[model samples]
Target: MNRLVKTALLAGAAWTALSGVALAQNAQPASQEQEATSLGEVVVTARRRAEALQDVPVAVTAVTAQQLENRGSADITELARSTPSLTLNSARGSNSTLISFIRGVGQQDPLWGFDPGVGLYIDDVYVARPQAAVLDIFDVERIEVLRGPQGTLYGRNTIGGAIKYVTRRIGDEPSMQVQGAYGSYDQIDVLANVSAPVSDTLGVSVGIARYLRNGYGTNLTTGNDHYNKDVTAARASVEWTPSDSLFFRVAADWVQDDSNARHGHREFAPILDSAYDTRAGAGDDNHVETRGISLTGEWAVSDTLTLKSITAYRDGTTRGNIDFDNLAGPILDIPAMYDDDQFSQEFQALFEGDNWSGVAGVFYMDATASGAFDTVVGLANLTTLTAGSVDTKSWSVFGDFTYDFTDQLSVSVGGRYTSDEKTGTVFRQQYLGIRSPTFGNAAATLLGSPRTNYTRTREFEEFTPRASVSYKITPDLTTYASWGRGFKSGGFDMRGDAVLYPNTVDGYDPETVETIELGLKGTLFDRFSFATAVFDSSYEDQQITTQYPAGATVASVVDNVGSSSIRGWEFEGSLRATDNLVINGMLSYIDAEFDEFLAYIPTGPLNSTCPTAVGCFVDVSSARNFQNTPEWTGAISATWTHWFADGSEIAFTPSAAYRGAYQQFETPAPLLDQESYWMYDASVVWTGADDRLTIGFHGKNLSDERYKTGGYSFPGALTGDSLIAFYGAPRTFTARVGYKF
Candidate 1:
């Protein structure tokens, strides 16, 4: 910890010295200057109002549309490569489901009963499920990532952090843009957007996109593609300004993914020719569909006050098959279906006075998530069917206010009171054949009575608070300190088997976190800008998910692990060395450890002490670690622009990112964990003088690094080994052309 503090101080000193030198070199008479070049100011809505990024007391990172384009980012997962203290990837066996974590806090299980530690929002509309949360990047204005708790002002309370995707709005004049791309693996992409004024008081916009790509490897058993992409998406929006004081906007979006089921590589088996290749015998067809609609209205009641309302509805469905063993037989196969729907409403009022500013809001949400899966065990000649559903009704009231005592000093405080109700229904049964009768196997017969058939309800209430103090040493430099609390509700385990574990009927407890942070954000000289923060958090009652052998099958359960402590530091900076050259970089480090962990330990043979045995509790704090929490993450990138004699412009960008080795689960498994790795990406773009024609070429993972992102393991559950691992994308390149009219 001392070493980290010293490093941060040294880095700050170095940046100050460099900025001083640059400023001295550039100083000159204003009358003699022909043109001025400086870093642009960034505006963010982190505090429920538009403000300069450097002036805000919270820690946030904003990525603009041009930045995303330069990096060739396709979806939300790619943002992790450049963002600090963020880990994002696709969940096991699915390509569209997202698993995300920030600062050592997040959720890996995409089940119905569990709540995500990190919140995902699109234009202020909260997404309630992870099933289709890996949104594609197109027609977007910007993305904001808040690092700490966001309980006040946000519709949904998030403990780890929050990610907001802001889309482009309708313009005043008619416009059209079309882009096409061709890449490695026969990848083809088309995107089109159009906007026009319908009347003097209304404007409309529409966008459509199609993305297709060949698989990185082949499925030897099914003769189908593996790790492929096939998606179609569309969005429409209407904006109306009836009067100078009133405004309204309605937006709707839809997405469908028809990609084949992604199969993993068996780590205990012989190495295949390609990391993406598999011999799974499950069906190849997989589908995911998601849609949402939102309406927002704002009224400027007076010069010092404004009223706003937001109403939204969203739904998604996923159907897929997973071959856990990656073998020809159905040793460990799962056929699953998931459905989720949500409706949310929020109202807010803003106040701006001479020395104070504040926002008060009330929010309500009604949501339901249901899923079912059949686990087929051919080696045991039996199957287990697990079906469950969870309904959530939540309401909250929040407010945040800031007061300026003087021009250089300010104080802010905020709080949120939330009430959450969760009702869950679970059913588990055994079947006689290789497949379950519910999965269309008519010959299969029931083995016995239902293992678990019951419904449970739980209610949770919490009051989270936040406070911060800020001081400005100069107009361009500011320092701040803040404290905040966050919460995540808990519910019943969907795959619980009461017959094996009698306590499975009782659900886990909610998790909470208290964090304290100190930060600095400012522009040194006009050419350099930076932001840094150091934080520590106390996490309590963590909900840990684990799989255990139950009779002849495996049951998934969630327990309240004792507690943990997490500390980390983040640094992000950008330097404009020359008029046309810019350099950007970020570095972060996290130290997360369990303070206490009470784990159940078996004392006898599997069958002797299995169902009726009372296990002993053991403190395994020293043996367990946090999942998907890398210790060191860093990235560096540079962009250089050149102008030709014909007035055309071309830009070149090159970047690289590094991530330290980390465990995928609490219990470390060598075969399922990923090692330290680096990824390299580069892009070159050219634009015509008119700024209407553009061409770009991008290359990702140039070194062809093969690394694990997620996996599954169930030891002793089946006769053969069931250790499977999923890999990220291999080397790929693309060429693109775009035009605007």
Candidate 2:
């Protein structure tokens, strides 16, 4: 038997065993007069309109605030454990920077010029940068994850997928809530929310949160905590409804993270006994701040027509240090700073006829991103300074409509036309000291001439389309087929060395994907529901980023690699075995391969294929693999509730998640890849008789699984070994309390 097939079978067996246990518990005898219970309906806005989840043709997953609270989720990364075909992690050295992938496609480099494969949105406003995108969970109503292309209705064009975070709206009545939690490593968290109505047509709301925790490990050289958290966040909103046909809202939000710089564990010789402990020499001072504000207006022109507008602006700043070589000496140290800002406006018109409904929108955005970093090599008394800035302007117009030929059959189509222009400025130079003059050094001397100093611009235009057909086999069952196209514009590389690679001045071309999918969503027996999908995609002009040695420093290159093919299967289901017990499970499998990869390979004496030069360009598709794409991911969970005679209640929830082995980079590195692993979590909560007071205890990673999330491998690039790995958190326990009035 094949190894992958065997592993998948074992995981499926475990899930079945767990399900059998839940079924046995539900088989107990019940009172003769006990009434039956059914699952509630789930409403979503996946198509820019509110509709039932089963009625939508798209493949999406919706998670409610109650579900998050029950699982004791802290940040967006937790979604990966429940959502199939999704992966998320914190960037290398920053606590708030996000790295996301969906369906085997995504970008890992968080530089100023690179674009993210998965888009992130807050209340319909797009976030242009990933520097401070790892949002904390507080005062949020729900979150939605869309699996495929989402360019028709959204404010931006995302190639792989999109994640939407929706905030809680102001209520009609006055209310206040406060929550607190304390846990391992002296963790302390406080969250508060308040809402009040000023008049019959006006209302306001405010939310505040504070999170603090000690590090999981310590820095031996700096005596600072590692992998700690210290953050403050707040949000405010005002709503006005002057009349019955018009509405307006204004919202503002801010977040600041002051956590210490995160360092990776050395994977070479013995440096420390613990995986989390580090001896990095970089100073421990890191900060990130992000703020945004938006205004939204809606007006009803007629009984079947409406118009809406959204305007938003956001900005962020980051300062941090990264110790590439986690040792006592500054063999490969980096100090970096980033600044980014974006402004966007969107206008939409929605219409509803007797048998047709649709939405048309126009979006425009202008953004700027800039960053600089100093690579210090104390052993050689040399420092390389690299700085770059990118400015972007883009606009798009899109529309989607669904027409019903019959009550049981319908067809939908949508298309988007987008134009993007990017301007980039790159600068790279060398200095003769530990630090550069740009990074607060006053006496640093210039070593040689600048390697790269140029400005360039590129423009790209694309039209993507989507179509779907749906039919209801029965009132309780539905099936659909869809095909969509996705695109992502390319830009110049920030660290490209023009002296060595002259072609870097022109930049790379855009990448695109076209996928076809078939899906089924239905319910049976009023107690079980399931959603399944099978998809195949053709990817073209893929942009690949690589690092190579350049005389005394490292050079970053971006190239338009060849094509690829990807196929996957996803399944999500929930069963209500009893009125008080429910079980949920998800399974996903993906097979991604490079169809053609043209790369530069070194030549050897024994290989006479190309003997004229030191290297030759050849096809290396069979030798490469997709990064961060696991072959199989599975999860199973159960929730049970019990009622006391005095009207009090308690709920018990337990879950387990599994992920198969995957590489971290396109170039395979055995030492950096992570093997298959499983994680377990459980929570218990008790509510008082009045239902206004609650207490909960939660445990995560119960088995204390030690697994890698990300890493860096640059063998023989610096003085010492440069193989470092970052790990997920270990076992943790927390107790939380809350009150409402």
- TM per candidate: 0.95, 0.94
> What lDDT would each prediction earn against the true structure?
0.86, 0.84
61-174: candidate 2 lDDT, tens digit per residue = 888888898899989999999999998999877788999999988888888878898889898888889887999999999899988777666633477888989899888889
In the range 291-386, model 1's lDDT, one tens digit per residue, is 999999999999889999999999999999899878889888998999999999999998888888888899999999998999888888989999
lDDT of 2 at 69: 89
Give the top-scoring candidate (lDDT).
1
